[model samples]
Target: MSRPRVQFMRRPGRLMLSAVAAFAVVQLAGCGKQAAPDAETTATLIQPVARLDLKVAKAAPGSRSGEEIYQSVCVSCHGTGVLGAPKTGDAAAWAPRIAQGFDTLTQNAINGIRGMPPRGGGADLTDIEVQRAVAHLANTAGGNFTEPPVGQ
Candidate 1:
């Protein structure tokens, strides 16, 4: 019985082509960091969409909900307790302040406490708005406080 012969051939041209292709792929698979935006581009992107003059705006009376006041202004400091401001939802941190009584708290909020600015930095916030925000913060920190109604 005769065995069939199998061909074993090497193509130098094909092997060289494969080697070049593999090298090109490895070279293209480089770990390069992306370049950051230029200063002008960064400035453009960081520019404020609208600049609000809080001072002028403060003169105009307006009613804002407690949650809105908190979100727009109080969150800046209370959210993170910046400069010793009582952090929201922190019962321990708020306990002493809450013990001061709701009226005192609202007064402090209106007059500006040790670290908290008046009206929680929202000069535009009305006295009633500040009271509501104070109630919201105090209530969240375990005090059973009632937020004042709007237009009060």
Candidate 2:
């Protein structure tokens, strides 16, 4: 009679669980001289990291169209007017900024405004692409500016 040997990793679910446990232990262990909370702490600690990973993964790609860049990057802050950003298509909000003139607005967008990061947080966007996106947002908000063609 022969006995069967079971390898731990031969079971994918078990391997995954083991890996997660190991990760939780390593994460908790890094804290100095603190008592670790049991199983529930692992899930709580992992959730924020997972959310941040998804945010980084969703970062905008380079050389996209104005609308695409707006949808991917600008929408996060601009669409909802987060952090004092003017909401897209808000005529009243865009009024003062439009009065600043197109060049100044695009320059601010390119250089980072009070709450906005440079290039509307799409660090990979080309200068012209950013300009186009600025125009797109401005137009949607009732401005009549025209975006220059790419490369000039």
Candidate 3:
């Protein structure tokens, strides 16, 4: 049993041999300086992807319809009858205001009426855009109206 225990014990000679091999590897890593790559070598290491998107040309300046203006600017308030905007679709809500005639409605819209902001909050809109926007709102409420030009 004592002889078997001695045979099972690890040999220190093998441990020392492994330690020397590890030390030689670490010393070799510290012995050499790395060389820099030439321009061609560097370029070969990194390849760029091609840009494949085609550039789109500009579109012509077209007339802005009343519906376009309403959706862009007025829809925030008028779309859901917010702040007593007379709603875009409810005839009962729009009736009294509609009876006032298109010209009055257009003027009020251009100048800002009661709780409704001017040009439905788009001051940059032309007077014609205001009139056409009113027509669009009025038409949505079942009133017949011709769309005015987006001028002046």
Q: Per-residue lDDT tens digits of candidate 3, residues 44-79?
A: 768666657799743223357888888888888887
**Residue pairs with clashing backbones, model 3:** none
Per-prediction TM-score to the true structure, in the order listed: 0.59, 0.57, 0.60
Q: Scored by CA lDDT, what does every candidate get?
A: 0.83, 0.84, 0.79
Q: Which ten residues in a row have the lowest lDDT in candidate 1?
A: 54-63
Candidate 3 achieves a global lDDT of 0.79
For candidate 2, write residues 111-152 as lDDT tens digits. 998989988888888888888898889999889988765435
In lDDT terms, how accurate is model 1? 0.83
Best by lDDT: 2
Residue 29 in model 1: shift from native, Å?
Answer: 42
Positional deviation of residue 78's Cα in model 3 after best superposition, in angstroms: 0.6
Better of 2 and 3 by TM-score: 3
lDDT, candidate 1, residue 104? 96
Q: What TM-score does structure 1 among the candidates reach?
A: 0.59
- What is residue 82's positional error in candidate 3, in angstroms? 1.9
Q: Candidate 2: which stretches are off by over 4 Å?
A: 1-62, 150-152
